[model samples]
Target: MKPQSMLFTIYGEYVRHYGSEIWIGSLTKLMGEFGLSEPAVRAAISRMLRQGWLESRKVGNRSYYSVSERGKKRLEEAAARIYKVETDVWDGKWCIASYNIPEERRALRDQLRKELGWMGFGMLTTSTWISPNNLSDRVKELTEAHEITEYVEIFTSEHMGWSNPKQLVQKCWDIDEINEKYKSFIDAYREEYEQLSAKMSNGEAVPDSHCFVEKTKLVHQYRKFLFIDPDLPQELLPELWLGKEADELFQNYYQLLNPGAVRFFETVYEAAPSA
Candidate 1:
């Protein structure tokens, strides 16, 4: 992970759990949890403080720190960027499911696999189903959209023993119980996407800094709906989806504006061509 990203994640955890009052030791502990070295942790903290994301008080030999309002806002935004929700429950019909994803949605398929893993989908064999969830409506939509229906199949009950009990214990992917936890997040994302689309159509500039901050918050909150992949090399498939969604939404909005602006902004933002 990028140092800045790691720093924000650590800072967010501290603020969320301990409020604004945090000690260096607690921060250090979080760093260890994330497998970061002490020096890297300190550097991230220093950078965050310098950026006005954290405020520190010096007393004796120790410096106590807490997230400033600016820091809090940034952390919230980062959380939105980093977190997402799963919309389905695994019925445990399979141990690992495989899908022959379309080229157009390769990224999306990769993202779904990562998310399914995060939600407890295991891989007994590549592209084979192994989640404990019964297929849900949302999952169906996602799979269909990615055109992987034929490639997917439920595993028989006999496949259960294939899972490594130790690994399963360590990484739980049961996400059915948390469906309600994602309602607000899904609503917020849809609302933001719609509003941003409108604003772009009206030729309004992408809101002010404060509004941008709020948008970022919504983006972070929006992530709670997607599944994450634990087995994937990078655990950011959800983040990648958000970026792609944002780019698509922006392009749609831009096209509604003056024609010339579309190419201009696309070049500046370096957006992928719309699918």
Candidate 2:
């Protein structure tokens, strides 16, 4: 994993729960477990700091880092979706965004496209995007952040076209491809889950370090779905969707690893003079 992405997973899964701060030394030591060098960790931290995703303080000549408010809000939103078991009923209303950024600001326009996709908006046309989720605040935030509010229009409306809702979904997203990705995830983790479950049942003593690594990798892998999965409501999903099954497996596997992982993390976190 890239050091920056790994750091995000670490902060979201571990540091946020324990005072939401860590000494640079503790952070580096923990990251070392994932084969990240101190320099790489430091560089990643610098980028996140510049991006307003992290804040730093000094205590006794040592630097400390914590997620910024923006980072915390982002992590919380991510966690809610990552661990969500039930999809909320769709309101049947669509949140749509349309933009006509000037060609001179092509870079900004491209960035807006990426951000919209990350926010789970699928392209309905060259300049228009749509999602079933209510995203008035998020839409406002992104457009204002990009200083393109005047160039964009936001709307909420029900489908009134000839195509059915599922057809609209098809035109906007590759549901088949998404389902295949979910299948791959289940295939990769199912056996591991079964083995771990058996080990715990047999009173086998698993190593804390192992748990830490497994949980971190599990979360890192699962979190990727946030970008790829628009998290559509059940009404828009296929009858045999694998997303729910994958979520169930993730939750079970995570719970099984939680105690050991937390213990390992705390052991490392408290190892510094003051973390």
Candidate 3:
């Protein structure tokens, strides 16, 4: 994994739970488990700082970093979805965003598109994005943050088209493609989960450091779904959707590895001098 992406996973899974702050040296040391070089970690930290995802502080000779408020909001949003087992009831409404940004402001336009996708909106056209989820608050936040309120319009309404909801869903996202990705995850991890469960049940000893690496890798791999899966409501999803199954396996595996992982992480984290 790239240092920046791994850092996000680390923050979301670990540091975000334990004070949301860490010494720079502790971060580098933890990152070493994934074979990320200290220089790469530093560079990634600098990039995140410039992007406003991280804020830095200094105490005497040591530097410390923490997720910014903006970053914390994003991380909290992601965590809610990441750990979500039950799909929320759909009100049969779509949240639509339409923008007429001028070509001269192409950079702003591109950023808006990215933000829309991150907020689970799928592109129906170059300037029109839609989602089945209620995202009015997030849309308002995006518009206000980017100063694009005048260029964008938000609507929440039922689609009155000839096509059915499933058809509309198919058009917006490749359900089959997303399902195949979930299948891949299940195929890769099912055996690992069974093996680990067997080990634990048999009283076999697994190293805390090893469990930390496994759990981190598991979370890193599973978190990629946040980018690809828009997480449509159950009524819109196909009957054989593997997302719930994948989530079950992920949760079980995570719980199996969590205790040891926490111990290992705390050992490294608490040893660092407070800054």
Error of 2 at 198 (Å): 0.2
Per-residue lDDT of candidate 1, residues 37-152 (tens digit): 87887898799889677877766666677778866754574454344333343333434455766687677677777746545465544555454444344356556756677755
Q: Evaluate model 1: give its lDDT.
A: 0.49
Candidate 2, residues 115-179, lDDT tens digits: the string is: 88888989999999999999878999989988999999999999999889988998998899989
TM-score per candidate: 0.31, 0.95, 0.97
Cα lDDT of candidate 2 equals: 0.91
The runs of at least 3 residues in candidate 3 whose Cα sits more than 4 Å from the true structure, single-residue gaps closed, are: 271-275
- In terms of lDDT, the poorest run of 10 residues in model 3 is 266-275
- Rank the candidate models, highest TM-score first: 3, 2, 1
Pick the winner on lDDT between candidates 1 and 2.
2
Which residue segments of model 2 deviate by more than 4 Å? Answer: 271-275
lDDT of each: 0.49, 0.91, 0.92
